[model samples]
Target: MSKLQKSAWFNLGLITISSLFALLCFTVAASKIEKGFNYINVILCLAMMCIIIPLTLIIAKKKSYEAGFDEREKIINQRATSLSLSGLIITLYFACFIPFVALGGGNIIKVVYLPVIFICTIFTYQLIKSIAIIVQCALEEQNG
Candidate 1:
């Protein structure tokens, strides 16, 4: 596999595992907290998972000066990035408007929901980008 493809796969795996781990931790912690649920704890747990972004970038960075990317790879990357950005926009639109439409203008949303929305946006972007890259690469391989 090409470096970019490998990186995409690594990101997909990292995201999947970290998300599952975070969910498991949250579930266990929530069960144990008898007093009541805490938004801070949930936010902190998600923020901790955000660390994976930098970690993925560091791992995916090219070690040598010559990062062998051809025109096809570049095109694939561009297309995948564009597709992901489009997905991000759609996700944001839904996230922002859905509650507003459902609840009307006078209703208030919790402050804690802001962080949840941000995290969900980030996940949506990454998920779309990774899936796009993988699918595009596979299509190119088949066409060749």
Candidate 2:
């Protein structure tokens, strides 16, 4: 595999594992907390996600000619990014509007869930983009 492809795969694996581990930690901590959960604890449990920042930085530091991507990779990246951004837009619209619609119909949602929703949206976007990149690369390779 090319370096960029390898990096994409590595990142996908890292995110998947860290996300699962974070979920497990969150579940355990939530269960243990007889009282209402603490936001700080939730944030702490999610610290595993911070590794992605450094991982991305390391991957990005390796320079490739022309933004580290060829035309095909660039096109694939753009398409994947566009799709992911659309997903984020749809998610944000729903997240922002749903509460109002529910409230108008006389229902309320706890504000605590907002953080979780946002976090999940981000994770979902990352996963979707990575999968798209990998799939595009695989398809191109198969065709070639």
Candidate 3:
């Protein structure tokens, strides 16, 4: 596999695992605590941000820059990025509008949901980008 494809797979795995871990932690915390937005939630959020995010960035760093990308690779990267951005925008649109439409203008959403929305948005972007990269690579391989 190419460096970009390997990175995409690594990112896909990392994001999936971390997101599932976060969901499990949040679910446990929610069940145990009657009151909302407690210390456990704060700690879980901090752990995700401080640990998983940085780890992902470090591991997925642009080590391929020294090698330089050829035309096909460059095109693949651009297409994947654009697809991810489009996914992000759609996720955000749904996240924002769904709550507003369901709850109406006067209702207030819990602050706890903010992190969930953020995580979901990130998950959506990474998932789409990773899938795009993998699929593009497969198609290129088949065509050649």
- RMSD (CA, Å), each prediction: 4.1, 4.0, 2.6
Candidate 2 lDDT at 12 equals 75
Write model 2 residue lDDT over 71-128, tens digit each, in one string.
8878887887888788878888888788778678577776546545655566676677
TM-scores of all predicted structures: 0.74, 0.68, 0.82
Per-residue C-alpha lDDT of model 3 across residues 46-65, encoded as one tens digit per residue: 76667556756754575546
Candidate 2 is scored at a TM of 0.68
Give the C-alpha miss distance for residue 23 in model 3, angstroms: 2.4
Scored by Cα lDDT, where does model 3 land?
0.80
Summing lDDT over every window of 10 consecutive residues in candidate 2, give the lowest-scoring window: 57-66
Which pairs clash (backbone N, Cα, C closer than 3 Å) in model 2?
none
Candidate 3 C-alpha error for residue 106, in Å? 1.6
Q: Over the full model, what C-alpha lDDT does candidate 2 score relative to the true structure?
A: 0.68
Which of the two, 2 or 3, has more lDDT?
Answer: 3
Residues 41-65 of candidate 1 have per-residue lDDT tens digits of 6675666567656655654563351
Please count the clashing residue pairs in each candidate, in the order shown. 0, 0, 0
Least accurate stretch of 10 residues (summed lDDT) in model 1?
Answer: 58-67
State the RMSD for candidate 1: 4.1
Instruction: Write down the RMSD of candidate 3 (Cα, Å).
Output: 2.6
Q: How accurate locally is residue 140 in candidate 3, as Cα lDDT from 0 to 100?
A: 99
- In model 1, which runs have C-alpha deviations exceeding 4 angstroms? 20-66
- Residue 38 shift from truth in candidate 2, angstroms: 7.6
